[model samples]
Target: MLRAAVIGAGHIAKQHLAAIDAAPGVEAVGVCDLSAALAELTAERFGVTAWETDFRRLLADCRPDAVHITTPAATHLAIAKECLEAGSHVFVEKPIATSLEDLERLAAVAESSGRWLVEDHNYLFNDDVQQLLRLHREGRFGDVLHVEVQVDLPLFAPGSRFVDRHAPHPAMREPLGAVSDFLTHLSYLANAFVGPIRSASCQCRRDSPVATGAISEFKALVDAAFGTALLGVSTGGEIDRFRIRVDGSRLSAEVNLFEVGAILTRTRGGPKPLIPIRNMVGRGFSELRNARRSLSRKLSGGPGPYEGLWRLVAEFYARCDRGEAPPVSLDAIREVGRWVDVITHAACDNATVSERQPEAVGP
Candidate 1:
């Protein structure tokens, strides 16, 4: 079995921990966090005897085949480099690095050290996203032309951590606030469908008092490969929602990433009567099917919402066992980071970001 360890004890890290537990042919050998109590608790719960309050000690003790860096986005580059130097493949959680330059440096380390640096674009493994890929590859959505994405969060949700003023939220303290944490996800999704972003104009604003100078809403207009893309993010919604729409010369499709379903419509000169049938077959069917399965999974003891996380973790270990490169190329990850950095700079009223937190970027 491939040996693995996680180095964070946050909510998201918990997801990774569970995924590692469920992953076949992989043993969670250790866990570490800055918080001693938290690290010990997590280790004990996972049946991992090697728990350390200090990350350096954890590395020295376990030296697992892979180190899952589930820490904050800002710490990714530095922690990942250390793991690589210590002779471990690194699986980092998203927002690879806060800036383009930092991302490039990590790329260099990966090249020089010959260790894989994989970022968790976990959403890419979602069933809906997988289906979207199939449709694209099968030419179901012929000649993709344009794209639209919407990411909304319900900040007012009764127990949301977003409203916790005392909590050290990575998004709230990052260079671009919420934008820093979210743009990577959106940018990568754009690249997956529309290709490299050639040019873009992005805007952000604080829409609520709880935002603490962090932007609560953002919008971007981007010129991508096939055509253009309009992307948006906002808070204080009644419910969380994430949706992406791809318009092609032959057909158009929409996927609700949050709802875990997709819908499609043919645009390439279909008869009026056939349009309704196509809607029933494509749009209505996916929603009904996904909803039923989602409910069933929740009812069962399966990895409920973050099934994609489990799949990605399992695949990362599988690749490690096979001595193969990561599924997402380092170049592709760098390109996505570049897109996010450019968009963040543009959205911040062209004010040069002269500095980031020392811990946020790698050397």
Candidate 2:
């Protein structure tokens, strides 16, 4: 069994631990956190012998085969670099690093160490999204014309600990605002369907709770090789929700995160037909209960979303074991980071971007 160490005992870390426990050929051997109490509690639950407040000590003593860094964004680069140097594969939470430079450096370290590095972009591993990608690839949506993505969330809610004080604090605020956090997921979708983004224009705003609360909204016209794409994100309002629409000839697919599944509309020169993708069944409280039960199964060592991510992780590890190329190369990730920089710069400047290109559908 490949031994693994989990750093960071926060809410997300629990999910990581659950995933590690469920993942085949892997065992959780160590747990580390800034809080010794938290580490001890998690270790006791997992029945691991190693528990410490210092990650350095855990790395040295445990000598785990892999390390999962779920700590704050600011500390990712340092911890990842250390783990790579120590000859352990690294799996880092999303927004790999704040700056493009740090991302490149980490990539270099992984390359030199002959170890694997995987970013935890959870949406990329979602089964529903993967099905959408397959449909796009199969030309179910003819010659992609335009794309729209919107993700919104209210900051102050009971389960909004994911968007709590740490959210407004410097550590969380500086690395990335709501745009980067949400766009990391959206970027993968845009690239998967519309192809690479050549250029972009965006607008952003921040509000304080006392004064209508801090909010960031952005609209970007992304230039894709095949066509053009659009992405918009807003936070600090209403409950959590997202919608993605891809319009094409003959058929268009719309997916709302608030909804269970995607809707496909087709026009064949005569009439429009609505086709519902029945991948997700049930609705109302039943739907919520089913979702919770599915998640619970995954968390309790059964197969689920985390299993998919673990499979990807295992694929990377397998590549390393065989001395083969990683499934997701560093160059591809760098390309994603470059686009991230572009969108962030545009948002900060509130710039309008336009490019002369092939005629594409848009608002």
Candidate 3:
């Protein structure tokens, strides 16, 4: 069995641990966290052999073949470097690094150490997304016209970690604050569907009283070589949701990331008046199918929440065993990192200019 360990036993850390446990041919050797209680609790739940407060000690004692870093973004660079140099593959959470320079450095280290450094863009492996990719590959979806991706999270909800004042989340320290946190997902999803973003424009604002100075709403329009994409990130919605809609030359499809199904629409070949009716019937059928699938999963307790994360972990382990490249290549990481920088920087710059503007005076 391949020995695996985890660091930073926070909320998401549990998911990483669970994925590690579920993956075949992998064993959770240890877990580490700044808070001994959190680490111990997580280790106990996962049935890990050991828990530590210091990662270096875990490295020495457990001697894992791979390390999963579920810590804050600020600490990812250092932790990943140490793991890679220690001869352990590193699997880190999204936005592996906030800056392009840091991504380059990590890539170099991974190359030198002959270890794989994979980021957790697990949404790419989501069931809905996988189905969409399969459709595209099967020649069912034609040339892409545009893509829209939206993620609305409850960052400012009653007990959200982001709203904690004493020890604010690392995302709150980012240039765009909490809004920048979800942009990493948007960047990769858009790049995957619409292609590389050539240029971009953004609109951002800070309107949530609960969120204080963080940007609570953001939207962007990016131009890619072949098409364009519209992306939105917000913390204002009552329902936390993630969804994507792809418009292609031949048909259009929409997938709700929170759910496990997709709806595809295309031209209906029938009488003019019946075309609309046929389209409506098609959508109804799709919804019924989705409802059935969702219910089945719920009843069977099969692939519950974060199914993509589980799939990603399994695939990563399989690739490592076969001596293959990671799911997200170095070049792909660099591309996503570059776009993330562009979008976040643009939003921050816009916020700065807005802050500097003088208020309207009585005329």
Candidate 4:
């Protein structure tokens, strides 16, 4: 069995631990966190016997074959390096590194250590997304012409660290503030559907007063190898939504990540006058089927919101067992960081230029 451990016993760590448990041939050997209580609680909940307040101690004592780093993005680089150097494969939460330099260094260490390094691009593994990818791969979509992705965040929710009066969340310290936390997801999704980003133009806006100079809205138009992409991220929205739409030569498809639903459009082979009505009925049936499938998944006590995470964790372990490539290739990881870097620079530069514009002097 593959022995795995987890560091950072916070909100996301719970999902990682659960994935570890559900994955076959893998065991949650240890759990670690700065908070001793949180570590113990998480370990106990997962039936793991070893719990440590110090990551070094866990690494030495448990000597796991793999470690999952669910800590804040700022700490990912250091923690991932340590895990790799300790002769353990690493599964790191996204935005594996904030900058290209760190990503390159991390990749080097993983290569030299002969250990796997995988990023938790969980969204790419979502059921709907997986289905969409399969369809694309099968030529159902022909060639992707355009892709659009949008994520609406609830950063201003009561008690969220973004708005914390004291000791705000580490994400609030990122270059893009809380939005950086989700850009990795957007980047990887874009990479998956649109290919390597050739160029991008971004606009940033600060509509919420939560963080000083931190953008609450981000929009980007990108040119890619396969096609064009429009990306959006907003922290000022009242309701959270994650949607991805792709237009192709033969069909168009959209998926609601939060709701786990998908819609596909194509030209129907029928009388031109009747095609519209037939397509509408087909869409209605598609939605109904999606709703039923989602309901069945929920009622069956499936992975729920973290279905993608579970699948990713499981796939990583399986790949390790087979001595195959890591689920998220190092090249893909670096590409994601590059995309984040470009978008961040573009957005920050735009914000700075906007701020520097002289105020109107006219009455």
Q: Top model by lDDT, which number?
A: 4
TM-score of each: 0.91, 0.81, 0.93, 0.93
lDDT of 1 by residue, 272-314 (tens): 7787787777766777887887678768776664777888888
Task: Report lDDT per candidate.
Answer: 0.79, 0.70, 0.83, 0.85
TM-score of 4: 0.93
Give a tens-digit lDDT track for model 4, residues 1-363.
Answer: 999999999989999998999999999999999999999999999999999998988999999999999998889888989989999999998778777677778888898899999999999999999988998899888889999989987787778888887878787787788788788888898789888877777888887775667777889888888898888988877886899998998888898787767888886477878877877888999999989987887787777868999999999999999999978898898777777777777776663211121223221
What's the alpha carbon RMSD for model 4? Answer: 6.6
**Which model is ahead, 3 or 4, in terms of lDDT?**
4
Off by over 4 Å in 4: 351-363
Q: For model 1, how many clashes?
A: 0
What TM-score, to 2 decimals, does candidate 1 have? Answer: 0.91
Candidate 1 displacement at residue 343 in angstroms: 1.2
